[model samples]
Target chain A: MEQARPQVDLEAALAASERRFRLLADQAPVIIWRAGPDKQCDWFNKPWLDFTGRTLEQELGYGWAEGIHPDDHARCLEIYTTAFAARERFTMDYRLRRHDGVYRWIRDNGAPYYDDDGSFLGYFGSGIDVTDHVETELSLRRALSQADQYDQQQKQAQWRQEMLIHELNHRVKNTLATIQSIAMQSFRAGVDVRSGLAKFEGRLVTLSRAHDVLTQSNWLAAPLDEIVQSGIEPFRTPEDDAFTIEGPPVCLPPKMALSLAMGIHELCTNALRFGALSARGGTVRIDWQVTGDGEGEQLELTWREAGGPPVHSPGQRGFGTRLIESGLAREFGGKVTLDFAPGGLVCRVHAPLPAEEPPLVGGLVVPHH
Target chain B: MGRRVLVVEDESLVALLLEDMLLELGFTVVDVASRLETGMSAAEQAAFDVAVLDVNLGGETRSFPIADLLRRRGIPFVFATGHDPSSLERTYPDAPVVRKPFLRGDLRNALARALAG
Candidate 1:
């Protein structure tokens, strides 16, 4: 009778402990689940059933697998089965279908549950939705990549700016050297120092005028007529029919325009001193045309003076003469002929026309074929 | 007759001044070339004791190639540039460089040093 009484008390105590466990599991906020040794879900807390909207019977055993996303089912089952067989702790992330027919990301953490006697009972696992967290991480990664690309573009722009500045500095120094050379040559060649200074200033002004035209064209080609006009306009007067210029529309490269402008300036200076423009009824005629076809195309220009003092070839060649003759010839890769006929000082230039659409100074940005 | 010198400068006024300076220094100016191709041809065809080369030609061409040809012909040449000397030293370590707008005495000294070498 005494042994029977103790057995009854033990049964009651076990029942009370089980009741307490059920109450605690039901009230838990997390989706708690228990799987048997066979790696099949045996029991789920109230939260789990509420999340999946499934009956206890439908959620038991392998029936719970229906809630897992088709894409994640195999991997999810593999992780659970492997952990169960080894009786090890495991954690994984997967997509699971909710009550609203939406697949949400969840992180599941499982551990081997043990009995009081140190024997493995089953796996106890808990899962939490991590959909928002995962999406935030993906967007952050994309933003970081975009920022990296923007940084690379900024660096490239900075490098280009530095290169342009360096080129500008080199050009400025070169211009200074050119000015020094002009001053030195002028002073050495001049019989009168003041006259040399005037000539030097005139040459500098001519170069400046050419630069202005080039700048207006964005350092591209300059019109030949505009260049001639710029050089001769200053020397024209109301009473003088001294200049007669006629030329077809011809676009000259920057270097060519600059050299030609200087050449024309020299011609005008000479005309004023001893050529056609020196006399009252004197006149100078300038004409040019494009000749030939295809690859043999050439630009032919003529400067003729008449109705002035009887033209005489000078015994000595001055800077003006040398610049107009040899300078233009070398620059254009052409021939220049000077004919000091008793009538007038006649000059003719034959040069190859530049290839169609020659590249401008800043046109190096385009890749060549 | 004086020592004949070749001047390879792209700028006309600069070349003219150089010619005058060379004449003043008792050197006969042989030829002046304003482009790389012209300079190369002049170097091959002309008779000159020494050459003055502008390092940068401001376009796609540089005078280094001409300098290389001069080297092969056993001709002494000096570099003139508006750039920093150290930048050019790596390529032409032994070549003397005269900065642009140089004094006549400086150019003469550089040329003399080049000839002596």
Candidate 2:
């Protein structure tokens, strides 16, 4: 009875120990293994064999190299060789062939083992798949570099184009000035229609003055001060302080500058030939003011002639009259009234200045960095 | 010293015209030079009763530098320009200006006004 009791207790202890080891290996996610000296595979868990899809005998010894990528075999072998010689741990990340013949990145870790006497014996290891993570990291780096290169190229192209445009504008301005100078000299050679020569020179001068404003403002909108001054430039005389100029500090857009220039030119020509600007001591007062209406915006301008010959409407709408009315009103989204006031000619122009915007040419917004 | 005047005009013809007009008005001509650089240089180095300047010279439209020099030297100058007066008036409110192709009397009047101011 006593002998039978001892046998039962031993059997119970053995069963409990076996169950604990099995639970540890089966429940754990990591694939684990053990081996003997001479790099022999003495033991491996179910997961190690399952991940490799190989039988125990097929994976014995260095047969596990079959799962290692062909390219990684030499480097991995060198690492293991060093470890075995030094009796140290061997751990690395490498591509391992999967069950389906595809290569996947795996976290491979192992440590050389020794007997109780410290002599080299064998090794054990764990592995985990990391193929997707490594691939994503590599692809992201490539995409980032490509974007950087494309942005750099676009910026360089934009700079070159701007320089070319500025150069072209400068050359055009110079040519126009030269033409005006030659024409004036030729007109002096023989003054047939002094009026006609004056008119031609006036136009060229207007264009030249406008170009000056554009250049000074750096191809941006022309200031109202500049436009008014430039318009009256060719007509100002020593004691002929005929035009009293006034306006708020406003920047006229390019389109508005052209139309307003032509209008001012007509006014100047008319003033010289007929209006208050025609006679000695004749004066023209010019002014503009801005005010916001219920709708959006409004500009009121007054061109009043103080001293001149008897005022009379030409009894016909010549280019000058129509120009002052229609041209000034066109696209102004506003109105204008020219009163041939018997005392002096008075022109009242009303326009709704458009809202200002950030400077940009064409569809591009200065191109983000 | 009769009203001595310095004429700084780029065009030789314009300069001669101004000189003749000044002589006729009993004013002695002190000097005449083209370009603002030389004009300012002359203004700095010489003493003058008054200066006459052509506003536009080889693309530079601003006479502020010459004006500054004259202002510092306490000498009055008038602008002789074919262009308009608004530009100059904005910069120099009290400075007198005489447009080109003028009557002999117009320059005389402008010179008198500038010297008086």
Candidate 3:
């Protein structure tokens, strides 16, 4: 009877201790689990059950592994089994399904449990949701990559801007050289100084007008009609209908347009001095057409004068003649002819057109009646 | 009566100015070329003591080919350009550069230095 009483008391003490452990585990904020020496989970705290929305029966003996993410399944099993076999501590993070059916990251910590006699029992582990931390880290990485791309784009833009500035410097220097050359031409020996300065001033105005047209197009290409009109604008008077310009829509590159503008200026100077524009009841007809196709395309432009006093060729070639004939021919791979017929003077330009560029829209033809 | 020099410039006015400068410096102008092909031919065939090479001959064209031809002929030349001179140092380290819009003195000095050695 004494043995039976002590046995019952011991049984009661063990039951009470088990009841206290359950109560403490259920109320703790963390999810707690217990596994046996056989590596099969035996118990889960209330929090663990609530997190998985599964009963303790379903979670026993590896049933809890069903809630683990498929991607993390093998790794989690390996870590847990290795730690359990070695009777060592382990820390791991893995995705687990919650009661709401959302997968969340969980950080789990486990250590081998021991009895008072220093014998290994099983394992006691705790876990908490770490989804927020993982999401923050992932988003930070994405933002860093985007910032790197933006930095690279900014560097490319800066490099392009530097190239443009260098081009601008080269162009400006070339313009200054042109002005210097014009000055030397105007003030050369045997020329009257005042008339030379006047001519220089006139040339400056013509160059400035060309620059204005070029600036409007961002220095890319200019309409041929616009260049001609701007070139002849200074020579126009309210009284006389002495000019006719007719041409199809054509777009000239910057270099061609500048040279053409200067050429028109020179031609106008000659016409005002001795050609059609020099006499009343006289007219100058400027016409052009695109001929041929593909690579063989040519632009044939002509200037014909009519009803002027009988004309004769000049005794010696001047700067204008040299520029129009030799300069244009060499620079643009073209031919220019100046014929002084007794009726009037005629100038013809035959040049190959550049390939694969669309003509300008909205022709600006000025027809004189 | 003086050093015969060839001038290679695309712009006619600029070429004229160079000719005048060469004349003032007592250099006889043998030939003036205004395009890459012409400049190359001049560099190859023209009989001259030295050459004045415009670095850019308009558009994507450059006078490097003419410079190479002159180099192969054992002819000394000076570069005239509006670009940064240091950019040319990689290819033509010893050749002197005379900047555009230069006065008679600048061209004279560059020509002198180029022909000295």
Better of 1 and 3 by TM-score: 3
Query: Global lDDT of each model?
Result: 0.82, 0.71, 0.83
Q: Give TM-scores of the second chain, every candidate.
A: 0.95, 0.91, 0.97
Instruction: Score candidate 2 by TM-score against the native.
Output: 0.43
Error of 1 at A98 (Å): 6.9
List residue ranges in candidate 1 displaced over 4 A. A1-128, A238-241, A292-297, A356-369
**After superposing candidate 2, which stretches have Cα over 4 Å from the reference?**
A1-151, A154-194, A293-295, A324-326, A357-369, B1-117
What tens-digit string does per-residue lDDT give for candidate 2 at A120-236?
Answer: 777877777878888888888898889888898998888857745644443444344334333443354346777657666676677578767866776557887788788888888
Local error of candidate 2 at residue A307 (angstroms): 1.2
lDDT tens string, model 3, A1-369? 977998999999999999999999999999999999999999999999999999999999999999999999999999999999999999999999999999999999999998999898899999998899989988999999999999999996686566566666777788899888778866878889898998788777877898889788866677888888777777888688788999998877666677777777778888888888888878888889989976677878888888888898999775666555645665667898889988888989887766743222111111111
Worst 10 residues of 3 chain A by lDDT: A360-369
- Residues B69-117, model 3: lDDT tens digits: 8888989999999988998988898788999987889898888888985
User: Using DockQ as the measure, which candidate wins?
Assistant: 1
In model 1, residue pairs whose N, Cα or C atoms come closer than 3 Å (at least 3 residues apart or on different chains), thus clashing, are: none
Clashes of each: 0, 4, 0
Worst 10 residues of 2 chain A by lDDT: A360-369
- The digit string of per-residue lDDT tens for model 1 on A1-369 reads 977998999999999998998899888777889987777789999988988988989989988889999998999889888878888899998887889999888888999988899887889999888999988988999999999999999997787676666656666777787688668756774359998898788888888888888778776678989898877876789775578888889887776677678778888888889988888888889999999887777889898999979988988776665665545677557787778988999888787776754442222332123
